[model samples]
Target chain A: MVAFDFISHGFIQKALIGGFFIAMLCSTLGVFLVLRNLSLIGDGLSHVTFGSVAMGLLFKLYPFYIAIPIVMVSAIGIMKLKEKTRLFSDTAIGIVSSLGIASGVFISSIAGGLNIDLFSYLFGNILAINWTEVLVSFFLSLFFIFLIIIFYQELLFITFDEESAQVSGINVKKINTMLYLMTALTVVLAMKAVGVLLVTALLILPPVTALQFSMGFKGTLFISCVIGVLSVTAGIILSFFMDFPTGATIVIINFLFFVLSLLFKKIF
Target chain B: MKETENVISMQNVYFSYNSAEVLSGVSFDLKKGAFLGIVGPNGSGKTTLIRLMLGFLKPQIGDIYLFGQPAFLFKDWHRIGYLPQKTSFSDNHFPAKVKEIVALGLLSKKRSPKRIFREDLRIIDKYLDLFGIIDLKEKFIGELSGGQRQRVLLAKAMVNEPELLILDEPTTALDPETRERFFDILKEINNKKAMTIIMITHDIGTIGRYASNMLYLDKRVIFFGTFESFCNSNDMTEYFGEFAQHLICHRHDTGDIYKKSYGRI
Candidate 1:
C-alpha cells in the first residue's frame, strides 16, 4: 500500500514532474531533429555529454553544471567545423560523437578506479530525483518549449531546405548552430534524470513514431508528446513493479511505440 | 509584384574555385519583369552564373546588386526565391506529403510559431490552383511522378510571391507534355504577373522559343541578348541547329518539319 502523505514525499512527486517536463522537451525537439535528418545527432551528442560528465566527476565538480557549458561549447564548435569543412551534418556528428565516447572512456580510466555507481550515469535513477532538480527541469523544459514555439517557422524552413531558408532572409548558419546547441542542452538536462545513453532514445523515438503517420508539424508535436506521456507513465509503472531501471525502461517503452508506429504505417 | 526596379545586376564578374576560372569578365543586367534564360552545355557555367547572381558565392572581381542593395546583405536576399535543380532526391520513401512540402515555402514568411500565415495560405492555394493540381496536395511527395513533384516545387517557389524566381534545370526530369505545360505556366506568369525569372538549363529546346533574353555563357559572357540574336549568332548555327533538330524530332509523330529534314536542324 502507498503512503498517503503527498507533500512530504516530495522526491516521488518531483521525479514524476521531471518526467513530464523531460517528455515535453525531448518529444518536441525530436520532431526537428528528425526533420533535419539528424536523429543520430541526438545519440551522438549524448555520448559527448557522457564524456563531459565523466570529466566533472573526475574533478569532483558538480557534473550537471559543468557538463552543461561543455556540451554547449562543443555543440557550437562542431557546427562551426561543419560549416568550414562543408561536410554533411551526419559526418560532422560522427566525428564529434566518436570524440565524446572515446574521451569519456579515456578520461575515466586514467583518472582513477571506476566507481560502480558511476556506471548508473549510463541510465539514470529517476526515482532519486530531489526538489531542486525537479523545479529546475520543469522551468527549463517550459522555457525551451516557449523558445521552440517562437522560432518554429524559422526552424521548419531551415529543416526543409537550408539554402531556401537563407534566401528567404533566415540566417540559416546561425539557426543551424543554435539548433545543435538546443539539442545539446536538452540532452544535458535530461541526463540528470533519464541519464546519458537513454536520453537520445527518448528524444528520437516519440517524434519519429508521430511523424510516421502524422500530417502537420503541430500534429506531429502533439502526437509525439502523447506517445512520450504514454511511455513515461508506463515506464514509471513498470519500474515500480519489476524493480527495473526507470530511464532505460522509459526508452524501451518509447522504442516499442516507434515499432508500433512503423507497423501501423505499413498496415495503413 | 513590386515595381520593376533593377532586381539583379552584375558587372565584370569573375569567378573561380581553386584557380579554375568559371566566369571570366561576365557582365549582365537583369531588369524587373524579364525572363532571362541561360543556356549552355554541361560544365558551361550556367549553374555557376546563377549561383553568382544569387550571391551563393562572391565573384572574384566586380560587384553584384540585388534589389538595389549589395548582394551580400541578408535583407537584400529576401526578395528572391530559389528552386534547386531537382525537387528532391528521394527513392521511394520520402515521408513528406505534397502539402507539407508546399508549406515549406510559406514557412519563411510565418510571423509566429509554425502557423501558416493567411497570405501564405492564399499564395499556396493560388499556385496549386494555377498549376491545376489542387487534388495532389494531400498526396505523398515521394509517391508523385517527377512532373507532379516539380509542380509542387513551383508552387513552393511562387508562395513567396517573389520578385525574382530562379530555377536551375527545372524541366530536365519531366516528360514532354509535362515539360511543355511547365513552360506554358512560366510564359503565362511572365505575361500576367510580370514576375522576373532566371532559368538556367542545358536543354536548349526549352530556351530557343521561350527565352526573352539569352545569356549563352561558356567561361564568360559568350552572348547576352534576345534569343533571336542568340539563334542568329555565327557560332549558334551549329548549337541552334542541333537543338532545333532535337525539338522537331521530339514532336515528329505529327509529321513535323523534322521528318523532312531527317532529324538534322
Candidate 2:
C-alpha cells in the first residue's frame, strides 16, 4: 500500500513515463552501435555533453538546448577525423572524449568549481523531471522509432557489408551521418534519466545482455528493449522504497540483468 | 542490337593511390554475355580496376561507362551485382541469418521503406534453391563452413538476377576441390543465364578453362583478347616466354574434359 501511494505521486509518475521512453530510445540504438563496434560512442558523446553543459552553465543558458548541436557536431567530427587520418574508430573516439573532458574541467575551474546543478546533471535526478521533458522524451522516442522502422533494412545492409552496400547504391555516407546524429540526440535525452556518467550503460548493457542469448537480429532487438524497460521500471520503484540514488540504482539493476543473462546462457 | 552493346567500356583509364601509380592507360570493352577473367600478379591493380568499374573508386584520368552510363553517376545498381574479396571482418559473431543476408541482395531494387514482401521471400527461396542452400536459410551465417558461406554469398549476389556480376578473388582461400566446384557453378551461370561476368583471379592455368576472354593485367593492359587468340599470339609468347605461355595455353586445350563432362558448354 505504501509503494502504491509512492507511485501515485506526480513527479514519480513523470519519471516513470519519461524514463521508459528514454530507455527504449537508448536500447534500440544500442544494438546497432554495438554491432557496428561503436558501443563507446555513447560514452564519448556524453563526455562532450558534459563540456557543453559546463559552457551552458557559465553562460547562464539552458544546458539541454546547448548540448544538442555541440554533441551532434562532435559526433560527426569524430567520424571525419577517422576518415581523414585513417585512424581506428576507437582512437578517434578517444581523442574527442579526452578533449571534451579536459575542456569540461577547465571550464569548471573557471566557473569557480562545481555546483549542485552541475552535480545533478552529472549524477542525474530523474525523480525531479517535469512534464515538459516527459513529453519531449515521448515524442523524440517515437520519431526515432519511426526512422528506425523505415531504415531497418538499409541499416542492416550497411552493418553487414559496407562495401557491398555501397555497390548496391545505398548512400553509406548519409546512413552513417544519420546514425551518428540520432545517437547524439539519444545520448542527450538519456543523460537526463541516467546521468552523464552512467548514460553509456543504458546504451550498451541491454543489447550486450540480449546478445548473450544467441537470438536472431530481430529477436535480439526485442529482448534488449524488454530488458531496458524492465530495469528502468524496477530500478525506479526500488530506489523509491530504499532511499537510493535513482540513476545508480538503475545501472546496478542493468548490471544485475547482464549477469543473470550470462548465467542463463551457461546453464540452459 | 542488345547483344552487340558493350556492357562495360573503359578508355585510357588511369588510377593512382597517393603518389604510386597503380594502373596507367588501361583500356577495354566487354560486350554482353562475355566472361572476362582478369589475371594479374599482386599489386597489379586488378582489384583496383574492378573497384573503378563498380564506382567504388574514381579513375584519375579517363572514363568508365557501365551499362552505357558514366560509372560515377550510374544509378541502376540493381542491374549489377558484386562479390568483394572475403575478408577477416566476417567474424564468427555476426548475428545475421542466412536468409537475411540473402535478402539484402533484393534491397537494391527497392525504394524507401524497403519492405520485404512475400514475393521477395519467394525470390530469395528460388536463389537459395538454385545455390542448393535452401536448408541452411534459417541458420546464422556465422555458423556456416567456408564453402557454405561462399555459396551463400554467391546466392546473395545473384538473388536479384543482375545482368553484370563482378567478383574479386572469390576463390583465393578455398581448397582445390571447392575451387573447382565454384568454377563449375560460374561456368553454368555464364552459359545458361548468359550473364556477363568480370572475375579477378591469380590462377593463370585454370582461368583459361572458363574465361571466354583473357585479360592479363600488370599495371596496364598487357593482353586482352579471346583465349584462342591468346593461345596463338606470338607477342604473348615473347612476353610470357615459351614455357609460361604453354602452361596457360595448355589448359585451354585440356579444358575440353570439363566441357565434355558438363556437356552444355
DockQ values, each candidate? 0.40, 0.57
What candidate 2 gets wrong by more than 4 Å, as runs, is B1-4, B87-91, B173-175, B250-265
Tens digit of lDDT per residue, candidate 1, span A1-268? 3535532466667777877887888888888887677777777778888898788889888778778888888788778877788888789888988999888898889887457555777787777777777787788777877777888777766766677777776777777777877788888877766787788787889987887875566777888888987898778767876888888888889989989999999999
**Which model scores highest in TM-score?**
2
Best by DockQ: 2
TM for candidate 2 is: 0.93
Q: Scored by CA lDDT, what does every candidate get?
A: 0.75, 0.87
Clashing pairs in 2: none
Cα lDDT over the full model 1? 0.75
List, residue by residue over B199-240, the lDDT tens digit for candidate 1.
987766555556677788888777788755654566665755
* Candidate 1 residue runs with Cα over 4 Å from true position: A1-9, B1-5, B87-100, B103-115, B118-120, B140-143, B235-265
Model 1 quality (TM-score): 0.88
Assess every candidate by TM-score. Answer: 0.88, 0.93
